[model samples]
Target: MLDLHHIFAMQKKALFFLLALCALGWGFTSYPTVFAGIAIGACFGTYNFWILVRRMDKFDRSISEGRKVASLGSALRFGSGIAAVAIAITLPEYFHLISAVIGLMVPYVFLFIGVFVSSVRNKGN
Candidate 1:
């Protein structure tokens, strides 16, 4: 089984770095709205990521204990993503809708990258 804690840690680090970049973009670039959108989306994405991790842990525990696992809260995550989009839509001047959508995908991107890196390192070892 994969180490959830380690994976989550890796993702958190990546997300923080991304947030820093967004901050810089907001401060130095003309497209402050775009960066702000991304930052907001990323915050929601991080929340979703944390929820997924918690659900996954519960799932693993249920499996080990021979109990049925509940749903993974996909709907909740989906709703949050929608809420991010809605926020951008409602505040058009403050956020770019497209950029907000892109921000919502940040965590998943980091997830894949982290897994790939982990696999490569394991292989090397």
Candidate 2:
């Protein structure tokens, strides 16, 4: 019911575009660290997003079967975000902490945008 595959495809496309922008910034701009941080965070963010979607799909299945599911793996996702931050902190010369933090949120931003666009498209049909 959720069209999860389509959602993931859209998100992947958006993240790839973002990575391209990060590449450009890293190459052309003065703040290479900032772009690098964003790129790193986005990569981790994409992984986290995939995990969430996969868990959600399982959750839906569990519900349909009248069974109990463990959780959405918040701990795993939290650890991932922490790991990204840790990487940034460990490499202070190569990555900006604030930018990495912002980058971690990029996937959710794209998710919201994609949902909004899909909703609008559906309404138009």
lDDT of 2 by residue, 1-125 (tens): 23877888888998999999999999999999999999999989989999998999899999999999869989999999999999999999999999999999998898888888888888899
Check candidate 2 and list the clashing pairs: none
Model 1 C-alpha lDDT per residue in residues 15-120, reported as the tens digit of each score: 8998999999999999999999999999899999999999998999999999998899999999999999999999999999999999999888888888887789
lDDT of 1: 0.91
TM-score of 2: 0.93
Pairs that clash in candidate 1: none
Give lDDT: candidate 2, residue 102.
93
Q: How well does each candidate superpose onto the true structure, as a TM-score?
A: 0.93, 0.93
Which portions of model 2 show Cα errors greater than 4 Å?
none
Which candidate tops lDDT?
Answer: 2
